[model samples]
Target: MERCIDGVCSGIFGSAVFSDTVMQERLPKPIYKKLKKTIKEGLPLDPEVAEVVACVMKDWAVEIGATHFTHWFQPLTGVTAEKHDSFLTPTGDGKAIMEFSGKELIKGEPDASSFPSGGLRATFEARGYTAWDCTSPAFVKDKTLYIPTAFCSYNGEALDLKTPLLRSMEALSKQAIRILRLFGDTTTKRVVTTLGPEQEYFLVDKELFMKRKDLIYTGRTLFGAKPPKGQELEDHYFGILKEKVSRFMHDLDEELWKLGVSAKTKHNEVAPAQHELAPMFATTNIATDHNQLTMEIMKKVADRHGLACLLHEKPFAGVNGSGKHNNWSISTDDGRNLLDPGTTPLDNAQFLIFLVAVIKAVDEYADLLRFSVATAGNDHRLGANEAPPAIMSIFLGDELTSVIEQIETGVVKNNGTSRTLEIGVSTLPVLPKDNTDRNRTSPFAFTGNKFEFRSVGSSQSIATPNFIINTIVAEALSQIADRLENAGDFRAEVNAVVKEIISKHKRIIFNGNNYSEEWVAEAERRGLPNLRTTVDAIPALIAEKNIRVLEKHGVLNRAEIYSRYEICLENYIKTIRIEALTMIEMASRQILPATLSYVRKVADTVASLRAADADYSCVKEELDELVTLTSGLKAAIDKLDQKIKEADASEGDSLSHARAYKDVIIPQMNELRAVADRLETIVDASLWPIPTYGDLLFGV
Candidate 1:
């Protein structure tokens, strides 16, 4: 692999991608124009044009050393899936020729029974279709051409995340265009939600990762003692990267760039072993695909450098956990960001309407927003003082917050003039991009031109959260458009609508600290829903209001919404069950035996001191404490084992199972961990079976 320096790397970017530029060069003029129109305008793809484009795409992929092809889709399993097939077809002469057709490129068949369907499909009805999503470009990787697609059942039910996301995008575009037309903007045909998801992960030594059964089985450490120096001083944030980690990041960027992923920013995170990678914004669908690729490439690159990339939300306790900051914004087809608050946003009615639409949407569908990022792994991070709380709120900076206040009060207050900082030194240049102080603790923060959704889990897919955002905002925009379309006075109607939204939904906008207990109480008093766990939040998916919004926007039907609710609950239950089982195994086979051996050693030391006629008080005290800890450890282990057995025996629906796991089994697991962690503190490091927090955090 050849390395290109930063300045000379522009040419290498998108080299392996079948991008629009490559399509234009390789495809005929008419075919390229038709395909681009289909992609941009969301029109039906012409089969004749697809055939020509497919042949050209095949030639380009083969030239780049691709021998096989696959329709890559994101299923409901929260990860990507693909099935590869060689491009070879048998000839009459016993040889083979490489060939690809428009039909094959446009469709794929994968077994549906193998995936989680939430009762949408039975085992006998094992049929699913993968249709090519032409909007997201194809790319070549590992001698294969990967075409992005959306998966669905034979009956047309969405079996994957991409289908609903695409539907939501179209819904949002339609409503946004209506609003734009009302504002006298006719040239813009579509509105696209753009996203820049900042990925955070931890890289630990491969040797250490392999030794921990908890990490290997559950993707998180079920049990580990806290390190002495665990981000306490906060020195690791933005610190210089070590040579080994830097090499891994370099290779990761190169691989991502080849696939046309805009890998832009890299830096150390607050945790010692954690790091963050942020890309430039792209359309929502493409950004989702690129982010998935970035995460896969991050692990693959780390493996080559003899490391294990941990994307689990709470890979370690007593430190900052990882989160994917979804910086999302909306833009017009002609390149105008709707969220851009120009010099005098108070006077910009168009921007104000769009802003209030978001506020109303977030306030109305706060439960849906909460459930979008809910997962068993994320439950450990949320409200843990490191990541955002489970409660959903918006953080419009001081300027926007004040604007909303004025609208609510029906008083136009002048916002103060922008001020520039003057340093004492003459040579220092003034900063340019400083508009408002950033709020890291806010879950959904409006930072200058975009709202950063900070509640998304690192390991989870961004497709669900983005789709929810699109659908809710579309509903709000639709309501505004309906009122304005009938109003006799356009300007008066616009002000009335904006003021009404501000008055009703202003409670969701909180500029104060979201991590504080005071805010939690205040939010409860304000009638905001705080869903603190995956199980608690998952039920909101099938709420009457939520289903109505989704169905009205054509994003998802009622059946699909119920199916997803079941799937989420089932997934959460399975995840916690696996973690509990892994904890049981580690405690029974590793921790208990090691603690017993240490107790024997301590007893021996005390005996020797007494035999020598010396004061054995210290040694005797140590042995007594060891005995007490061992007793507590054994009792907790037995209790956890009993609870696991009870949970396994209890048979019920997915919701009941999940509730049992959360309400009954989790408390027992926590008790076991408490005792085991205490034992780890007293036991010898050499006897401990798994890697300690210090080694995993600092060894890299």
Candidate 2:
């Protein structure tokens, strides 16, 4: 296969091909220019030009040896889906023509009923539409042209994350344009939120992974005792990558690059067997597409190296779980980062306004922000020592916090360290990286110029969270614009609005550790809702305020919002139910049998000793203890089975059922797991039915 080996990008994954020059070559100049204009200016795409662009795209893809095509989209199931079709047509009696039409390139019909549309689609209603998103260009991989698209139902309801995310992007741009005009930024016709989602995951040997049915079926080890050599040593994070792992990463990067995903950074993460991949920033829509592709390719490429990529947030207990830190920021068309504070504080009032808007948005909608990341997999990860807590708190560096505080209090405390700019020389002093302290524990943290949303699950699409982020910020900016547009004095009005927001919602800003028990209590005392589980968080998705905000901005209608709520809750319940059932199956078939076999060995030893010396008290005692423990394990398994049955029997709406799963079913599962784990340590290795945590974690 031909490859573009660029020395500049040799060490980086995204540096090789997706450079501006390559994009220009791939697209016709006129089409490319218009596409850029549309991407930058939020301009409408002309269908005529779309056809021409489609022709160019087909030719380029064919040149790249793409014989098939698929509309790649992110469904609410938190994974990507695609149906590929060969781009060949019969011309006459035995002659075949390689062809693809513009209409075919633009749209696709996938069965909606098969996908989890919450309650949006009925069993008989199977029609769903996938519209081509031109902003994210078509990329070729493995002899197929992959067109990034947004999935929606036939009734025009959003059935997937990408559609609402795209709408949110447009909503943000519209509101941001209004704010920009107020700041005299007429040249900047559009604004876009850029995202760089850093993905963390674990890679285990595929052979070992296949041995554990829990890992194979549930994407997690439903029953594994803690390894003696876990992350307590703290030696794995940022440690040198293993040779095998490095080789896997290298192959993964090459595959990702070929598909036009800019996988930028690869590193060892905190937990053992955990690793991270960071990508370069792009428009939110394209970033979402690239992230979905990155995840899919990560697994596919890992398989090539005999590795199983585990994206589960808490695949294992008693260790750090994976999360996707969504680094988000707003930018303008003219290569200007709205989040970047300019040299002069007075001259960068425009920037400060945008920054304040993000702060306020995070503050006002903190629960919804937290809800965006709510999932069963993530519930196990969040509030754990390594990951951020469930409570939504913003971490501005100390400098920015102080600046905002000063503005709020009308106290300019930087009264002495003043530098003067000379007329004939450069005297601009270096500004410190002060904003707020880096609170790793905070769910929402400001890292330099962008906000790092740390609560998102490793396996999540990142599209939904960004969608919420953009919409909330857009709402805040719209309100800010409304005040500034009518005010007599712009600076005074901007400062007042910023101060009012900070003063009113300053409680949302927490520079301290969010993982602490004290912080959880404090957050409650301060009136912040700590949505501890998915059941608690899913309702916030359809809260009246959330519904109003989403509908008002044209991001999602009432039906779409309600559908997502139902879908998310149902997904959570179903996931836990599956885990429960898997645990029950493992316990009955594997664990119980293994324990009984071990018990039999102990009993045989006792009998042989008694036969040899008729007074073997120790052997009898050991045999009795083994029998008791085995009986206990059997009882626990039966109890878990009963609870699972009870949960299965009770029925209500998704939310009520999800609560029962969390409150009733998960406890029983845990009880069964505890007894099984204890038995694992006591049983002989040869007699054990499944792989242990020590084997799964350190095997590679």
> Would you give me the overall lDDT of model 2?
0.81
Show model 1 residue runs off by greater than 4 Å: 1-6, 343-347, 414-436
Clashing pairs in 2: 396-436, 397-435, 397-436, 397-437, 398-435, 398-436, 398-437, 400-435
lDDT (tens digit, per residue) of candidate 1 on 1-700:
1122366668879899998889988898988989988998998889898888788899999999999999999999999999999999999899999999998898889765789877788666779999999999999999999999999988889999999999999999999999889878888878999999999999999999999999999899889887789998889999999999999999998899999898889999999999999998899999999999999999899999999999999999888889999999999976688887544423267777888899999999999999999999999988888888998999887766765676666654554643321111111121122355667889998887788999999999999999999999999999999998999988778878987898899899898889999999999999999999999999899999999999999999988898899989889988998999899899999999999999899898888989999899998988998898888888888888888788878889888889999999999888899889988898888888788999999999
Worst 10 residues of 2 by lDDT: 420-429
Backbone clash tally (model 1) = 0
Residue 159 of model 2, lDDT score: 88
lDDT string for model 2 (532-600, tens) is: 888888888788998999999999999998888888888887889888888888999999998888888
Off by over 4 Å in 2: 1-23, 26-29, 122-125, 414-431, 434-437
Per-model TM values vs. the true structure: 0.95, 0.94
lDDT top scorer: 1
